[model samples]
Target chain A: MKFIVSIKMVPDVYAPFQIKDGELLMDGDRTVLNAYDASAVEEALVLTEKHGGDVEVVCIGSAKASETIRKALAMGAAKGYHIQTNGDETYDSSSYAQILASFLSDKEYDILSFGKQSQDTDSGLTGGMVAQLLNLPYATNAVGLEIEDNKLVVKRQGDSGQEMIELPTPCLVTCSNDMNEPRIPNLKGIMASKRKPVESLSVSDLGVDATALEAVSKVTSYEPVPARAAGKKFEGEPEEIAREVAQLLDTEANVL
Target chain B: MSTLLTYVAISDGKIKRSSLEVLSHCKSIADAGGMACEAVIIDENATSYTDDVQKYGASKIYTVEGDAFKQHQNGSLLKALTKVNEVAQPSLIAFASTEGTKDVLGALAAQLKAGVVADVSSFNFDGTKVTAQRPMMAAKIMGNVNVTGNPVLVSVRSGSYDLKENPATAEVVSVDVTVESGDLRATLREIISATGDTIDLNEAEAIVAAGRGVKDEEAKALISELASVLNAGIGASRALTESGVYDPSLQIGQTGKVVSPQLYIAVGISGAIQHTAGMANSKVIVAINKDADAPIFEIADYGIVGDLYKILPTFIEEIKKIKN
Candidate 1:
């Protein structure tokens, strides 16, 4: 089964940053492939590797996104499609979903995949939005995926339990990072990625009205999360401190 | 008057308290803004929850009942929500963020052409727009978001607002929905439920989370005993869950469940930012780890430097004594 996975380039959440006067100030330009998308790419690669098929990735980002696409190519994806955008546009989940939907409108694929949510934003709306816009069957927060009887079986983590769902071909799924540990690209794979093909296109080239892609929801500002003040730390004999803290929970904290 | 509709979520034969919390908040907003407060419950036994839902001050209750609504299917849910939105014509639709809501929120928004914000910790609707604050960059920072549309959609994280009871006499309105077989693109095979009577960590008042230090069955038993003593839910760090020591449903971290319980006890957890991102909002945090300098201590209201094997037994015994 051929798979087309939608990937994203996000700011590295691990990078050191500061918020001042409602503005987030990062230390440097540290960007990486979204962790959840990396898992989606990895899962698609694994499935296509087992069954004889090709795994392709489509990404929506600025010029810097080619590095991210190469990272995926280095991990064994057969091809990449970069939907280039000006970095300054304030695009929300809906905008990205519309762009991806327009790009994938006439594309042929058995399964369309995406990360459940971006690591930085965590909005988790784009995948479902794209599925809806494309009128495709979809599932989200998938922890396990398997191909059986020409169908995609998804084990999605729900509120009550893990639900096993089966969808026919031409379906969509948003993968959770719990699915698998993404493999790092080796030296040989990196060398091969340099020779891989990456097709770059503008939003207008996809026949989408760029003016209609206005984001209804936008982040107005950033602020530091109020720090939780640390209380007293007791270090002494295990039994003594344990009993004392338990009493404190009852009398002082009133939680017990 | 414009309506503010709250989607009351049902899980495991019970209405989610978080949904009631959202309703309570919406009711207050409606009252202050001079708008009508309403609610929608889409379930197999939707009408059964009407009385309980009325306690939160929904003047009108919309119920969409059928066997197709028995389980969480995004197709049926999106259709039901769309129908309800058409009937109610709500200016703002609110939801208590759940896995079910997350599965369908974006699709519903896209279908309705409505602006949406998900997993917001706090939000308010002004006359013209809805503004919300949510954790970004893995809870390392907060982002204020503004959403604009005819009917703005917002999902609130559990524990973001306190539950305030304001009873109202609600008029029950049954919504007609038909889910043909063709509409269901995905079929649920089965559910691998967690073992019996495991409290939901999202709604738990207190949580006892095991980390890497909880290695053996003995430590697991101790953690269980402590949780039982305090009537708290049992959770696990990503290390324990990924290592197959605990169920994935019990995993508490950025990639897992983001919880803000009344009390959170971290046993044997050397709190990484990823883990703390989920539980940092707990009202009271207690960290018990042998490593005195564990980052958990930085945010824990009470930090005890000790081993779990020794500390847990004494701690559980003392808590049991205190409860008695």
Candidate 2:
């Protein structure tokens, strides 16, 4: 039951929206694994620990992705593969998944996992796209999963509730936040992670043609939403206040 | 450009306002190119909503009927959706952003080999090309995406678009799909409704949210006070929700509810991207934090850089006077 979990280090969501003409803007400081992907990693770790298998993490991005690799290792992954020296922050999920599928074709891993969606882009496309590329059985927002006789059984969340699914062993699942609680990094685990073996392979070295990718971008502008006008306060009975609010919604705001 | 239609709903069978907003966005997309708007409804009773769908401007609807179809189960839904795709061959697909929507949509996209753009706030048309705007650094840096495939897919964040009820009537077409009883693969068991006096944040017209900057639990009493005076729902950031003082439903952020009330008031929240991405779309965003440097100010329509504990009461008093 070998496993591969993809992890991404996303910018802190607490930062301000940066919409300038020339330079990119976002929080520059702290880096945490995208929340949903964290559940994916934790699920992979839990699966490997239960099934008696070594787990490897495959991270595709610039050197910044190395932090993702280190975090995966610290979380008890046996090792990690860094697809390094590459990545534009805006790479389309199709290209990213394509690059990884090509890499996975030459490798052997039973199961694949990733965040249901990235916090940065909120595109849960990477895992699904990779699974499509590989032509494997895939599930997303899997809340319940189990292994039986080399096949996989999972419960995926739907709009109203949940669904049960059974597929062969070779598949991919994008875990959501409630999949599992991500373990906190301990001092010992962090220290031991340094000793773990990590192999960094560049896209060019891995037989990937760097120039074949498309360069696409969207945001021509980013700006803060306009402020609201001052509120008109009211002091009266609850029913009276409701009447005033109704009037405001009907007259001044005309939103009622 | 290919047009995709996303359906938005809340607990039980209520049509969420967010879904209406997503429909508005879909309208904008259809107008961008020659894209036609079609909706995929999984609710148990779709016939009752045809008038409502028309009000949202949908030209056609692919209604899936069944008790099983009522609740969203990713696997069964993926299979059912696969069946629908095989039939309708819609050029694009879309869904409202939700935990359940994200899950089934990911599987649907992968199993169908479609492209995905999740949590998009805005999108523009370039002739036949569709460019979408999504949050990159939480909501700090916006990223653009161009979908090249025929069946481009997207999930609209809650409340990002202005909802409009179009006048045209929509055609409801029922579709039959096979979903085996054994095929029920996931279990939601139950939805432990959150306990609180506050209205559901997702459904609220106005929200007054609090954060950790409130020195103690006693401070939440003030949040309730303000909410009561304004006839608004109460909300809390993830920090406060996780702090065990509030129910999970009250939590507002990327991991929680994405609220877009007409008026959003924040107390002690320091505008983190995780937090802002949830409430940035509010019609009027107001933040009050002692620290003037709080990032919340960036998105806030109004900011009073003063202690929330002191200002909230005074502000409520001021509003009370104005109302009288």
Candidate 3:
């Protein structure tokens, strides 16, 4: 069995985001592997380790994405693949799905995995779109996964509870963060990652017409949410503070 | 053929409030465009929610009833939606942003060859194209997006729009959309419920959340007591949830659940940017921490500079006295 996992590097959720000249300033912002995508990579690596196969990490981004792919490689992925994008162009979920489906068509894989969502946009669309594009059996928000008798069994989080699902080998799953605790890349793993090969491909190389990859939606503006002003503060004894806080919430905040 | 359609999701045999909100929004968009507002419901008893959706201004309800929809499989759902599309030919489709419908909307977008504007917080119509404002970069930067083509699909974030009462008569029409046996590529095995019968974090009106400052294991019970007293959901920051101090389902942060509760009480949380991003949208925020300079105070409407352990007990006592 061979596994292919789609990963993304997003702005660190803990860092402050800034807008410059009416655009999201990504160049200077700190980047980290999407937390959910890291869980996806962990799930894929676990499955591959159990089933005697190799896991390959893929992403669609600028040159900086190589670091993200390398992070996955350090976490035990066999290799990494980067689909270089033309800078300054934002692609929607549909275009990204189309490109990934086209790329996977020529390759053979038993399973495809993706993060449940990206923290940046939180669209949670790519994996399902790709599954639809490929017409494959798919599941999302999987908290549990197992491979048995050439079938993929998964437990996914739903509205009310977790639903267990069983699909065929050639299936796709979007892993929720709870699927597993992502392993940190150790010093030896980082050293080994330096020796591992990372392959790169442009849209043209993947046979996708660069001009045809137009975004379905265009961001007309980017701005920060207005900051809330600091209000009254209560100090001193716990009793005094608690009473003041409660009174303020009930009278002024109107939320009690 | 130009229609504004909203997909009404059924949970536990009822139309969710978030779905009704989406329907209300869709109706407004339809009114603006001079189009009809319709709703598509897929359930064993699809017509059951006709009155509910109609109350939210849906002029017509499309029903697709079958055991295939009893357990929501994306393949079966797409087929039913495709059938509805063939009949209605909606120019625009909308869905409520939820864990239950996100993947379905994604698959539907690919099947219909339509572009999707997902998790939109607000919408603006300039008599032609609908521009949606959505949060990007973890609610730090807002992205104003324009959905250009026909049959554009969007998922409105929960609580983004109010559910308006438009009181109208909606015709219930059943569509003959059956799932072929061969199309069943996935099979439901079982369902596992999460622990604790507390209110869901996303659905809670008020939340009592704990952060890393609650050092001891016994503090969880203290927070739980406070939550019960306030009739609020119990939530925790990633530091607590990831460290096995609390259930992961109750984690509220950037990588966790994003909530817009009417009231939020943070105990012992030195608000990281990630945690703040999730709860900043709450109507009123109160932070109780030992550190006077905890970042949570930046957005908190009320701040208590003291140990949460001592403060929380007194706070609960005060609230109980007021209630009594």
Give the per-residue lDDT of model 3 (tens digit) for B36-129.
8899998988887787778888888999998888977777888898889878888788888767677687888888887678888887554346
> What is the alpha-carbon interface RMSD for each candidate?
0.8, 6.7, 1.8
Give the per-residue lDDT of model 1 (tens digit) for A1-256. Answer: 9999999999999999988788888854699999999999999998988887899999988999999999999999999999998888988898999999999998999999999999999999999999999999999999999999889999999998899999999999999999899999999999999999999999889987766688889898999889899999999999999999999998998987
Measured by lDDT, the strongest candidate is 1
TM-score of chain A for the candidates in order shown: 0.98, 0.85, 0.89
DockQ of each: 0.88, 0.22, 0.69
- Please give the distance, in angstroms, between residue B76's alpha carbon in candidate 2 and its true position after superposition: 2.7
Question: What is the descending DockQ order?
Answer: 1, 3, 2
- Candidate 3: stretches off by over 4 Å: A11-17, A28-31, B126-128, B195-197, B214-218
lDDT of 2 by residue, B1-324 (tens): 354655545346677666777777777777666777777676678667667767777887777777776665555676667877776676666667776666656556656766566777776554345578776655555565676454666777767777777766677778886677545433344443445344656667889898888667568888888788778888888787766676655778776667788888888898776787788878877677777677787776566666565566666765666556
Residue A83 in model 3: lDDT: 90
- Per-residue alpha-carbon lDDT of candidate 1 for residues B32-103, written as tens digits (9 for 90 to 100): 989899999999999999999999999999999999999999989998999999999999999999899999
When summed lDDT is taken over every stretch of 10 residues in candidate 3 chain A, the lowest stretch is: A20-29
Identify the superior model by lDDT, candidate 2 or candidate 3: 3
Please report how far candidate 1 places residue B315 from its true position, in Å: 0.9
Alpha carbon lDDT of residue B324, candidate 3?
Answer: 69
